[model samples]
Target: MIFPLTVDRVFADRTRAEIGRSVLTVPAPDGTHVVLGGHDSTGPEDGYPIGVYATPAGEGRAPGLADDLPAVGWLRTARPLRAAAFHPVLPLLVLGTGSYDGGYFFEGALVLLDLASGRRRDLFADDCLREVRSLQWLDAHTLRLLLAPHDDWEDRAARSEGHLVDLTRSDWRAVPARSLRPEDLCGPRVPALLPQPTPPFATPDPESPRPGHIRSLTELPDGDILLTADHALLERWSAAGDRRWSLPADPRLSGGPLAAVAADGASAWVEARGDWRRESGTFIRIALTDGTERERHTTPGPAGLLVSSGIPLLVPVPAGYGELSRSLFRHGRHAVFRDTPRAACTCDCPWDDDEECACACACPLCAGDSMDDEEVWLTVVEADPAADPTRLAFPGTERRRQICPWSWEPGETHYDGPGVWIGETDLVMATVRYDGAVRVPKQGFVTRRPIGEDPSGTPRWVFPVDRTATALDIDPSTDTVLVALSDGELIALDATTGTLRARGHVHVHGVPVIPTALTVTGPGRLLLGTSDGRVLTCRPGPG
Candidate 1:
């Protein structure tokens, strides 16, 4: 019933290279423009595929960039681009770059280029970041940024945090992040965009019931809320908003962030994380009544544990790697170069500026056998634990279906990795992978599928559009899907037929608002966490 897959990373890269996605062109205040280039798939021999090209603004539009600006500046990086833009009115340009630790998060740099002097400096040139995910020029004097977490070992990974830079201040200093409204994105004189945060949950509460590592939120038979917090902590809350009791989080047992938690007829099944730093982890059994450890075992985990039938099922994911970044069964090692010893080779990717060539190693263990060492694949194996841990396969072919089997199809795109379950049986997915002839992760699709017996299931309907979806949530009451796009657009779609229901560029206090966290509260009501780390609650009108 599981569809295990081994994505040919190298072959995938070569395919992307052949596609050669085009660059994005944004106009400056003047007639001149800024072109943010694409990433190169072949190798880092030339540099990271990202580049910044400026064209000379003559009396009119320059006919040809190649002839006019023969020498476009290249910003070859091993990391990827999170945000790139030109200063509102200055000759300086800025970009945010980072490597994806996993999923949509990245670790990287805030690079600034002085076009007049042709000198560049990385604003956040430190080694501590995943990447600069959001960047904006509030004005010529100020810039704002939202940095991705460098690691996902704790609660910080789920929250959006940002930094403010005042050109007025010479050196970098951390400042509290301020939410943006519509006027902020389009620049001065625009009307205030987003509404204020809804009452109650809008304000901050330092001492409030802040729960981390929310592995699962379940309701007991009597209407009580059973919430599993981070570090193996569990709490029972009354429907009246009272904290009934919290179980002890013993350090001796597994106390890291839990992956999943479930309650059966008697005991609760919890997947506890280990102190991956020590390369050690364990699964522990607890007695629901006394809150005492019944039994525990050491394993290659920081895994998700559950009880199926009578046997214990443990899902060991790629741990110690950034969230959503690791493989299901890597033997604590990545694919090494075929021609070199694990010692002779840095194992670092060339794009990251490694001085060696991989000739592309494709390790089934890590999918690096052919992909760049820096590339990480998204794979999951759902099955019973094997006596010999070496045997593992994700999305196994049996009972499996290739949702979007054909890459570069005429109208379809690739699966965007993660998706949400509609109600309990259906799924809603978004992607940016079609064969539109553009090299960019352009308008993809948000599709729905009715899963029954097959894993290679086809979508019931496909909603095609010009935006790359970043997140999605379904409103059961309204029968609509809320899609968060990378470009700061919040939209609603007809859930049943895959049609557009509503669309808008949400903004607060003149700054356009996008969402990093989306939760459908009830009916037409929803909560949105902005890229700037701010929050807003609203209901989109019907189409």
Candidate 2:
């Protein structure tokens, strides 16, 4: 059941150029070829056809970031990726993808990809069969497929399609349905998004403020909360649970969703994008007093809130290149051209002057890849938009490490999680560790580090949580670190000692929600954002 998949770097670049998205990867059973799944821009009327391709399964190579692999075979089928399985003994593959059509039928395709001949054929030409839920091989000559019903809206008896195909047959469409064996049906495989249940420490406030995906929130100097919603809506709420003023959604700012907001005096900076896929965005300056636009300017790339010395400035935000940016932050590597070798040098020394390193190894500083190679720096961004604005980068030591799937080399550690600013130059970050593709969060440790100087020295303190931290904030007055865990627990910790102080449950309307963002409005008072698009004002009573 385990078919390892290597990174297909060229597939995304190629798909993006064709105005499409590459979403799924299915490696062949024999491990010589792999199948790619996605949709292209030009498609038929039914829907976006799933573009399937078989490419060579390159093994042992370093998987160069720039090398492009040509497709050995191709199949364009309607619908997205569903279930796909390769024949146990032949050079044949079967896949199905589709959903309930708006009409009375569930229209989809059961496609077969022939690796030996580079040809594709659909088993069914009509819109009667539902999506193929699972594909399995009973033997070398027997292939089994389980499909959903064509229509299941009425009170009729539930029906499912199961077919045991004879590989010797020329046409699969004529194969009659038969009763499935226990081995032919697969159990629940795809996970559903369900809320994690937890005990409620605080009762739900019936009059909770309803906001649609609170993207960014900040407490103003006068206790007003300025926040942005899913689209371009900007709103201000008073301390006494009242909506002060809301700016209507503007079509001019419809580049993309509003990413973040940073308040400075009477003006607030609201970042709006045409879309996350675009390279440029706009930062609109709006008056906090009346929700009116003051001014705005176009930014070069995706910009986010970066706080330095209590001053919020717009800075470049890492898109999907978290591992690459982290390597630059820690190792000071700078060249990202496709031609540069990933293992150019094995020096364990930081760059001395950008021309060379202190180690005797011919350092590849010039040909290295980096975010900013000028000096050591500590850059921090909130796991969510509203946790805190803390970005720190200083000179750091180089450590040879294992690579996460996202990194280009085997030297970068992925700490791309929430961080809360605890001091002028110190913050606590949730570190992520990977064992190949499996995330090892239990072995992960939370470390507090100073960002104003060389970070090679021992950290101030280290602690382990054994769980993923969804959001992190700090009570500046008490130095108590606030952590919103992914499992619906709100934890408080001593910031200076890294010791657990207390823990409590968090719920929205008596239902547990995974906290996505948090902002401490005041001592014992806070605002919590949930994954289901809710903004709740919470006041923790005694215990």
Candidate 3:
């Protein structure tokens, strides 16, 4: 029986909005204040405008553009920040912004700002060069710069250029520094923000055939392990951790990059993802016996592979700026332009209905205009090799057929992560939280729902966890589902009741282990693929 309930019931716990990332920071020489930089939109396509704020050093708070920070200045660059520097012994600031133009050239400007008088000027005299990788004040009057390549032409020697400018000069023009090398300039590095697996306990010998970064892993029917690494290679490992075979996922032969892999009786199917700008992928079948190529078929966009009842199903993952984009736009934050609604309501209502209602029923400007613009309808692609892949709607949400209306608070963005089948009928899934500039799956929850076509079907229960689950597997003997967390936590939940049965941390030889993949090898025994390119087996007990 289906029971109608409040939208809040859809979530195990209330969701919260996440803060965006900071652009660049330039601190005062005395350290009394810090000039922070960031953008006001989702990306450069939407005329991205970056803002600069001077916050008190002791305040210890990084404020967003929407926050009530004292804005020292703002720039309408329509570009992302690349480098920034504060002038010494002078009331001035230099900010650089640019990025790859999605095509041939890297473009940006070097803006000189007069902090005392609010005056600004673009220092570049012509379009001969762009993109400041770093800046250093050579002295009180001269500034040093390292500009990225003008175009994607060739190697670093041909693309990188450097300049030196004396602000005291009448023109303040930049002159090419012939002796400057790319290594002479330095700035903050782009971090590996995504959660990563741990390295092996000890480094491999220099000559060992190293398995690159593991993306995903699964256990084969014959007790062997199969995994995709670096989006290029697929390798098989024996039950005892011996390398069986490795195959290259050449884009010409296997779509683009290896994404999802599934195994059948004697064959395995691999999905190679498409480029970010397109919505197509490739599905290739390989022989399990010797890792030989078999057949290939064009498939759907970057998706997950699910095999049930001897059938292969492709679940399409949403592209960029999905439902969360709408929420961000509604709350006065930067989001994609298409995601912004044509209209919205400001009144408080229990439900968004337009007819037979008492609240704003006749108002055309009410909030009842279907809040389902970009809702991702869960679907599956057929396994036809000679015909176009047909998309059939599965048991997920669609436009105006929401199973769980969003109940997240302002500033919080939510994302559904990977899932696993607990039994023949019930499906276990995880929802992650967006933090800073990336989605931090470590901060999410788990839920279990039965297989059905009802859009409003309620889940069996929702189990909120403090850490995000990186992988999941079932221990059929104990009727328990094991969740492997990115931070090395192993949680066992009752498959029938959704109750937490046990919690343990994964460690090896006193070294903390970060798990990237996991599976139940046997009764009470678990196998894990770590970020450090190593496989380990452990039995959770009182340790």
TM-score of 3: 0.46
Using all chains and alpha carbons, the TM-scores for the candidates as numbered come to: 0.39, 0.46, 0.46
Residue 420 of model 2, lDDT score = 63
Cα lDDT listed for each candidate: 0.43, 0.48, 0.49
lDDT of 2 at 283: 63
lDDT of 1 by residue, 226-309 (tens): 444342345455545455665645554433322223324344544454343222246555444445555556554333443222
lDDT of 1 at 319: 36
For model 2, what is the C-alpha lDDT against the true structure?
0.48
lDDT of 3 at 486: 58
Which is the better candidate, 2 or 3, if ranked by lDDT? Answer: 3
* Model 2, TM vs. native: 0.46
| lDDT at position 504, candidate 2 | 66
Q: Write the per-residue lDDT of candidate 2 for residues 1-543, one digit (tens) a residue.
A: 001111111100111121023444556665665554543323122233233333434562311213344445554455665667777767777776665566555556677777677566666644344466556666665666555554557813323443333233434333443322334334333321211222221222344332224444566778767766543357787766576776655544431222233424666656553443332246666777798887777755444433333433444443322222221111112210011123223334555444645455554433445633222224333222343433212212231121212221245444445666554455566655444544323345566765545435246787767665656777766777777665556778788898877776653212233455677777766777544344566665531
